[model samples]
Target chain A: METTTLIPTGPPATRPRRSPARLVRAAAWIALAVLLAALPLYIDTAWLKAGQYMMIGAVGAIGLTLLTGQAGQLSLAHAFFLLVGATAYTVLAGPTDEERVIGLGLDPGLALMGAVLISALVGLAFAPVAGRLRGIYLGVASLSLVFLGLYFGQSLDSLTGGTSTGRTPATFELFGFPFSNGGPEIEVLGVPIRQAERIWYLFLVLTAIAFVLARGAVRGRVGRSWRAVRDNEAAATAMGVGVARAKAGAFAVSSAFAGLAGVMTVLWFDILKPDESEYGTYGINVSIAFLAMVIIGGLGSVPGAVVGALIVNGLPQALTLFSGDLGWFGETGGGGLTPILVSSFIYGAAIVVVVLFEPGGLAAIGRRLTGLFRARPREITREETS
Target chain B: MSAPTLREDLVELQVDSVTLAFGGLRALDDVSFTVEPGTVHALIGPNGAGKSSCFNVISGVYRATSGRVRFGDTELTGQRPHRLAKLGIGRAFQNTALSPHSTVLDNVMLGRHALTTGGFLSCGLRLPWTVRQERRHTERAVEICEFLGLGKVLHAPVAALSYGAAKRTDVARALAIEPTLLLLDEPAAGMNAVETAEMAATIRDLRDALGISILLVEHDMNLVMGIADRVTVLDFGKRIADGTPSEVQADPEVVKAYLGSGSEDA
Candidate 1:
């Protein structure tokens, strides 16, 4: 999972624990975190909403990268897991007074955990099929889950609230403080931290946790096992990594992330609306969008996945916000330049550019840029060692 | 870094009349050999002579058709491949099957998977115990790498390594498993003469220092004869000779298997 662009020559003595380059990298990350934490203060509600949407994408993309990139499993069933998560949360936290839908009336915090767990269990159930197939076959096999999700969404109207008019999810709360606007009003830097501001901070915290956890896994023993399984099954087995278990674990973890993203999706819209078609929310298009985020970012790269999510999800939201001011990205009678269409074109082109010029994606390019700045020494070539 | 201590109760690996068949073809027919404890044993045969098949069956990658492989009192045939590591058996591949993109240290750390304990949650959270475990195991892995002369390229990607270096890295990884029995398949397969000599010395040094039994499969006869205490010769899926290197080298059946059976008839 760790792909180094700069190949250093010489002995291990040159590799220091805290090199100047590493300190610079650490400082840069700290600065980015501080800036993101401060963004909610200056940005308007619309912009915060955009950032929240991107955070949702970031969480989902991180999961996909671990499974598809690190574990080397192609999965197209992310949308199904997302649906599972969204439905689970809604049913668990929806008001018991509702006549149309089932509600466990669990606390919102508990419901969120329940949703992620349900999604992970659903993912584990699919692992049997995932274990048998590889590459495109596994991908196609997993796609069936989306159709199943669609069927459940329509058939289980009591649970899904009949796509026409979805159920409203209970406002999320941490202990006594609610994420909704009705809670005790709070002000940060004289900016009234309303629901939008609150949710933005909520998402920021979640995304940061997700990012940190994923990085830890990538750098730890679990990440090594996944990469080992990805590289060679026989060797992985010989190295004492259970091939099937590793694959199943990867699927479960990835699904849990997608589940969290699903909960975020419902919160973002304030409604648990299941997709009517395979092209709507929690549809095949959404699955491909998540894949696009990972691929455009770089397979198996934690931070790269975030950058990918920002581009793929943040672009459309940014464009929509800008169009409100420019008024040129209005929907056409036929198929003209809408924000979604324009953003789609941009990301599609970006994928093509990444594939052609840099198969390593943005992460590799970032490594190369940093390597150029360092200009250490000539890397030991294959010929030199021979 | 302190040297990793070998298990005191090292036991011999016994392959007793193992036969592995695939459909109508018999990859290994009644092949048998015993690797004495703390000694280097080599399985040598021509191309397509079931050397790798024998290795695979013993390593639990391939189950035998009719036979038993026992490491001391434990029956190993029915055990899962992943369980072999737990049985104190560590194997290095003939093709250097280390992950190419990962750093040498990371690849070596994988050998410590069975020894360490942690899952996604514990590792992802970097819990106190997991962190301590990682640091301690990492220290051992670094020592193993340095032992294999991979100290210079410890952080280098396996893909960037030379063929000899990559092969050594594979051995280093196997050593990281902390096994009482080490299975090395063609350790010097694609190496130059100097590299082959170095590998021979390393194998001898490993046996002497770690007190671990080494089972090797090699086409390189010089390295095998130099380091292997006992050599097992196979031909046409059958064990032709098993004895000390000099005794096996003088055996007529072994000569015919390597050269041509027609030579004796002529």
Candidate 2:
């Protein structure tokens, strides 16, 4: 993750004076929100599911961006934390009467929150090692956690419900209202809203909250220290920013976000099966995919991460929607040209292009486009040696 | 606060007999010195004479093999660089370790980290208290920038700034820490004559107006001799001369080792 891009070029810390450009940006954001709100009405459940999946990607990518992009800590442990969150959610929310698995039988809402907290604590525990290691060393060390999670999921059947006959999570409910078809039937402007529609709203809210909080962190004093630490550890320490704590905190925060994504994943799938193979769902490839989102998004840009997630995660969902309509996949099944494979190839190319050409990724492009609309195209500074 | 004496202040940076070794090679050998408060103390030597190594030891970047450092009454031998900042020791690196992608103001704001106390939660949530704290720190950074004549490009990313501007920004950043003592390493190394004069003036003002003690490490004899109250010369990590600027300048040994024996006399 790079911290250099988060610097706000605007001055006056008390209140940034409003400009036409900022208004345009705000208006664009509002338009995006409106479009997201209206999508369920026009699009069927399958498309909505695809959209929901990308939102999940957005949530997880935001967290990764904070850790890997902003804090400059290379982490391949997002998948491990995701599994931890999912397992924690399942174990805590499973019914007390369930015979085969361990269950706390807690409130679904509390269980959801507990999942985030538990995963974050686990990440924090790993931080001592994470903090000590740098670059690929940290990445390899974090990779060990994914393997650890794999073992835990396989052996600890009481918590994760084993690899084969995975348990179903209790449907999440906020207070008396269940976020399911079982809840009181509701309609929106003559449109019949079902489980898929309801879950989309829940995910929407979670994604929005995640995005807002991340944006806040990126623009604040904490963000400054993260960038400082990323750019130069000595400089950061000299400025009184505890480098280790900041690194650890970045991991914890990112894990918490991934944990939320895990909870969302369980709710979406309606099942909690641990992947039997390392190449499957909760595996190293999943971690790589998440990292691809951050890199394509331009490391530390909060909004860029979301766009990266959309490109990486949204493609497969769209392919799934086209599966029935398009029988072209059957021909390439022998050649291993699955939707995921194709998406991987595309994103792989994206990463290479991003690195080779625009190192800032999509965020730099976005900045330049926005810069064009500025009132005074930032004064080209001169040395003026006298 | 107690009043300062002509030769002394309440606190002094005591660098007790310190030695640093990398296997068989000794980087520093029983080096001892003190930066007296409210005075300009210059540490000068030829390149690779362990002046930077001394700075690394003082700022806690490098652990000394056998030595004890004290910031007034506090033991600072094993203290972290961040902890040193809290203890009122500011340092400006020769290469200027600034976040080049960030704005000039943001880089300066980093220097205010020790003086301000807002954690991740408050800042991440944009809490009212944190906003207030952040504003106060920014205000102080702004003042530092203005004092250094770097107010014009506060919003410019450091990467976009000229070398002189960036150098000034680095110094302003150090000052933003509000240190009782400032350690400057080759601050005017690449500067033109005018910029060097400006830098010398700033160092003088810092000692005079802000009453901040300075430990200057520079190869520029003119700047060192003009501004220093006391000069300490090093030869191969061992202290060769420690005296007033004129006394050290006149010393035959100091000239032989550093000033090359006869520039002024010839």
Q: How well is each residue in A145-264 modelled by candidate 2, as lDDT tens digits?
A: 889888988999988899999999999888978888887888888787888888998999999989888888887777888999899998889878999998888989999999999999
Model 1 misplaced regions, further than 4 Å: A1-16, A19-22, A330-333, A375-386, B1-7, B263-266
What local lDDT score does residue A282 receive in model 2, on the 0 to 100 scale?
Answer: 80
DockQ of the two-chain complex in candidate 2? 0.44
| Residue-level error in angstroms, candidate 1, position B19 | 1.4
**Model 2 interface CAPRI class:** acceptable
* Docking band of candidate 1: acceptable
lDDT of 1 by residue, A90-124 (tens): 99998888888999899999999999999999999
Ten-residue region with minimum lDDT total, candidate 2 chain A: A1-10
Residue A310 in model 2: shift from native, Å? 0.5
- DockQ numbers for every candidate? 0.42, 0.44
